[model samples]
Target: MKTRLGCLSNKSDSCSDFSEFLPPAQETAARSLKLSTDEAEQWSESFDVLLSHKYGLSAFRAFLKTEFSDENIEFWTACEEYKKIKSSAKLVSKANKIYKEFIDVQAPREVNIDYRTREKTRRCLEDPSPTSLNEVQAKIYSLMEKDSYPRFLRSKMYQDIINRTHAKCQRRSV
Candidate 1:
């Protein structure tokens, strides 16, 4: 089945190279990432914890990319950034941009929202507010929490990080 981000084959070969899932900058940054064992386990505590942690969020985003569902996080993050805009003009412009990119019917990065939520988000573009995208963003957040977050916790990528972190801790204590 096609996911929220884009379609990819089910074969593990499709994403065999983890670097293919991240941009060049992120690949470099992630390569240098050194996550502690304690912090790695803490990410599994909740989706919010994972997102609030720099390395945890990066790893989750990479996992989502491999699953072709990164758009959900991108859109959710964009909505978060959108809410913090203090300028009226900038807020309206960003609202329209976000709508065009994620909420429009044929948006390149359209999220898997129902028609009602999509239309409601669209209507807010006319007179944008800090909370303009709150409803749709909430729906996306719930979807990720219920669906992607669990799979991410169980993903090989996440497991690898935990194992590697544990090994590193062991070496330090040795």
Candidate 2:
């Protein structure tokens, strides 16, 4: 079964497939949202700092895909979205869906979390709230921030964005 990661599509089963399968239009748009020098500086400051911008999050998500840990970010994003559901009915269903998809052991895109965190999240189903997944989400966020975020700063993919954006800025000034 194919796992959906928002608009990104690929024939490969997992995000680790390294093949460049992004649609041309998306690739172009991603490139155009290039990281300016100041943006790069801010991104380097901290993970939360970087994620504040949509472009930064997109670039980081792409980097996570290469590492086969895109599910972590994907789950984190889902939880963030889940928090915004004002309808009690929608909240319950969406919370359950997120748990089954990213927290269940048999889930195709299961995220990495301790048994304790998983159990806590499972318990949240009894009485769903906007903060149902807060604990687990924080764990994933910390994982990305401590482990992946630093590596992403040094990644060629990131450097390329910085370079491209710098060049674009230079061209504009000429």
Candidate 3:
């Protein structure tokens, strides 16, 4: 099935070659949050750890390029669309369209990877009922509050694992 992140959920199909971008275990829990305002703020707080420090923004951009396939094409398209759109609020929308319509479709091989990433990201925020919320939240928050880039990158696989755990918890709660 197609996942929100535009990747296939099946584990067999790996995404791109940028496996080095995997986040650390401690921070993976927190870094996998949905691409929302809170997540952005959280990322911003750890800008050093996320962007300028190591493979932060560069890694993210690389992953995005792999996920999207054609880097500049879509970004430029989004930029153009963003300019055309009368509403300032549509910037994200324009960008998303650039991602979903152009980028996602351009690369079929990476769809599964995108889906996996999406599914994993969703799982990070969930918990089984109210009981595990504290634990899950704490797990992620702690990682975000502390930790270095190298330490986090070493345990990148945990990002997907943590996502699946959250998904399980959420399903149990539902």
Candidate 4:
């Protein structure tokens, strides 16, 4: 049986091609989160930590991309941006765009929210508020925290960072 990550195999070629646009991991690691290795481990254990850290968020995004669930994070971030819109007109337009792109049933990047959450979001769009997607976003956040976060902690990518950080620290102390 093909897994979600397995399904992304067809996109690997494109992912590789596009990856060239990504900053080097070292740069991303240093600039993105700015957390120490110990802090990174701690951040990996909690959603709020990861969300607060740019590097944690970037790493999580990379992990989600591998699983083909990057849409969840993307949708959540879009909702955050939508919430920050000051112009009423822009709020409505951006909210609708986000809905059609990630919340709509046939959306190309549909997230794994429940029907009730989806329906609630749709209703919220009728009179869009900054808090419109708050509930659904929380759900998505919980899903990532509970499911993907643990896997990320165990991932080789994460481990390698921890190892490198430890080695660097040891060198400094010695």
Instruction: Please give each candidate's TM-score.
Output: 0.83, 0.79, 0.20, 0.78
Better of 2 and 4 by lDDT: 2
Q: Model 2: per-residue lDDT, tens digit, 1-174?
A: 122232234232222221223444565454433345677667888888888876677668778888888898889889999999999999999988998899999898899889999998899877999998899999999988889999999987666656655655777699
In the range 63-84, model 3's lDDT, one tens digit per residue, is 3444343343234323344555
In candidate 4, list every pair of residues with a backbone clash: 32-55, 33-55
Name the candidate, 2 or 4, with the larger TM-score value. 2
- The stretch of ten residues in a row with the least summed lDDT in candidate 1 is 1-10
| Order by lDDT, highest first | 1, 2, 4, 3
lDDT to native, each model: 0.77, 0.74, 0.37, 0.72
Please write out the lDDT profile of model 4 over residues 1-174, one tens digit for every residue: 123122124333211112222356544334333335676677765678877776567667877887778898898889889889999999999988999999999999999988999999999999998899899888988888889888888887566556655655676699
Q: Number of the top candidate by TM-score?
A: 1
How far in Å is the alpha carbon of 49 misplaced in model 1?
Answer: 0.5
Question: Which regions of candidate 4 fall more than 4 Å away from where they truly are?
Answer: 1-35
Q: How well does model 2 score by local distance difference test?
A: 0.74
Q: In model 2, which runs have C-alpha deviations exceeding 4 angstroms?
A: 1-35
Enumerate clash totals for all models, in the order shown: 0, 0, 6, 2
